[model samples]
Target: MRTIVITGGTDGMGAALARHFLRAGDRIVVIGRSRAKFDALLATVTSDDRSAAARAEFLAADLSLVADSRRVVEHLQAKHAWIDALVLAASFIRQHRHITAEGREASWVLFFVSKYLFVTGLAAPLCAAERPVIVNTAVPGTRADAIDFDDLEMSEGFTFARSNAQQRRANELLGILAVTDNPDLAYVTWGPTRLVRSSFAGEVGKSMKIAAAVLGTLLGQRPDVAVRPIIGIVDAPTPGRAAYRGSKELALTVGDHDDEDAARLATAVEDQLR
Candidate 1:
């Protein structure tokens, strides 16, 4: 069976994706930070035939730190020589700006930094796979803000929208540069305009929670439908671009942004990493 590695596979979009892949007879190696959620997911798998547990494996890691991300991949490298796909669905929304232990913004670390580390670290095994693909869950219609070289963290004015925009742009640039640099592996970003349900909203304040609910009911689509792009891309990924919620071939790379801009943003990201 082909092996798929998923981050944040214990809940929300990640968990939904994992269930679908598992049903397809693929082995899943999930990386998560929550033991409770992991156990719950395992319970769901094992509840229907205990032997199904063999098809699933898990590793616990706090992906907010770059070092920890590398360590997680190193651990994986020790176990498996090849991996068919890597789906990064790990994310959380912090209303106020918070800095990670790595001195990076929490959302940036979760959404982009950890993903970059995971993808780069697992490059060798990915190349070894028969058909390796990288699927990233991106927020659709995200504003691709150019990273301010001076204030990368936006300590000046930190709103969820602005921070999320920064992270989304970083992810886009990373995909562009990575696909260009590593032609052996195909990368696809799945952008859904809105998702019907999100576990990410469960941990927020009551007001935000209400808003999340309203949005889900009003503007969102079912999780399965919202995740259609991810499923499609995993089955067949385009090397250097992304797909939105609707339409198969008609996709906007980085959500209708420019290729040259993605390249320039990649350069800026490289500089930031240095």
Candidate 2:
């Protein structure tokens, strides 16, 4: 059975994807902050499908912390000899800037650093698999110009919108750069074609949450529907680096394929972790 690892698998799209794969008889490993939520997710397995429950595993972690992210990497590497798919879906949305105990912006660590750690840290096991793939659910092609290399932490002028946009750009660059290191693994950055109704709506401020709920009601797909293309890619990944919005493939702009900028961002992340 294929081994699938999903962060943020306790709820929303990640959870839906976990259930889908479990029903398909694949082994699923989910990382999230809440043991209770993890239990709730596993409890959804039908009584007749005892094997689905048996195949599910959960790792409790706060991806917002650097140490916690690293610890997760260590734990996974030790336990799983080979991983077929790694889905980076854990996310946190804050209306105001919040610094972690490690003295970095929360989104920078959670959205970008944690992803970097997981992909790079799990390189061996992922590559060990016959057809390894990573599906990062982020806005890939929408924000090519949002990043500022000088101040990645957004200390100067921090706003929730800008921070979120910057993180999306960082993730795009990550997908590009990661493949350069391990050409055998396929790294796909996927953006939803329409808004998705998920727990992400509740994480923002009241005003934005209301807006999200309205927008989601008007133009959103349920997590199960939205996860189809992601599963398709995981089953048969595009070689090297690729980006998608729903099922449609997006051509990378010249800016998106900049090795120098991608390398620079990688170095900055390494420095931040140090």
Candidate 3:
């Protein structure tokens, strides 16, 4: 059976993916912050087939903290000798700037840093597997200009839109750099063609939450529908780096895959983590 590790597997597309893999007889390890949600996911999946419960595991960590992210990496490394797929799906849309106890912006840490740690930390186990793949479920093909190298954390002039855009670009760079660093593994930036209805309403302001609810009702796809293309890619991933919106491949711009910028961002992240 294929081994899949998913961050944010308790909700939305992640949860949908977990259920799909479990039913398909794959071993699933879900990382989430809430034990209650993990238990709920386990209960829901097990209700269908008690045997599937043996293939599922959950690790709790506040991914917004660097230390927590590191601890999770260590734990997974200790437990899994070979990981077939690593899905980076954990994120939150913050209407206001929130700093972690580590003095880093919460969005940057949760969205980018934690993912970076996972990809790099689990490299050995991932490469050990046959047809290892890393899927980053984030907005791709975003303008690279959105990222401000000087203030990656958005400590100055922070806005929800700008922060979101910056994190998206950062993830794009991550896909580029990871493939360059690990040519044997596939790194894909997977973007939803349509918004997927999720629990993000709880993280935003009252006005944005109402707006999101209206938009989600009108334009969002159910988590199960949104995850179909992602599972397709995970099953038969192309080597190296690529980006897709649903099943359609996107062309990358010069800035989107800049080696210099990718290296610089990696260095900056290393410094921040240190």
lDDT of 2 by residue, 117-204 (tens): 9988999999888899999997676556788888999989998789888888888888777777678889888888888898882257
TM-score of each: 0.86, 0.95, 0.96
Candidate with the greatest TM-score versus the true structure: 3
Q: Model-by-model lDDT, in order?
A: 0.74, 0.86, 0.87
Better of 1 and 3 by lDDT: 3
Tens-digit lDDT track of model 1 for 120-201: 7788888788778988776544555555545666778878778777776677666776666668677766666655576753
Per-residue C-alpha lDDT of model 3 across residues 1-274, encoded as one tens digit per residue: 8999999998888989989999899999999888788788788878989999899999999899999989999999999999999999987778889988888899888888899899889998898889999999877877778888888898899997898788888888887777776787888888889878887623777888887789999999998999998899989988888888998988864574488888988999888777
Q: Clashes in model 2: which pairs?
A: none
What's the ranking of the predictions by lDDT, best on top?
Answer: 3, 2, 1
Let me know the TM-score candidate 3 reaches against the reference structure.
0.96
Pairs of residues at least 3 apart in sequence or in different chains that clash in candidate 1: none
Task: Write down the lDDT that model 2 would get.
Answer: 0.86
| Clash count, one per candidate | 0, 0, 0
For all predictions, the C-alpha RMSD in Å is 3.0, 1.6, 1.4
lDDT of 1: 0.74
For model 1, the run of ten residues with the poorest summed lDDT: 246-255
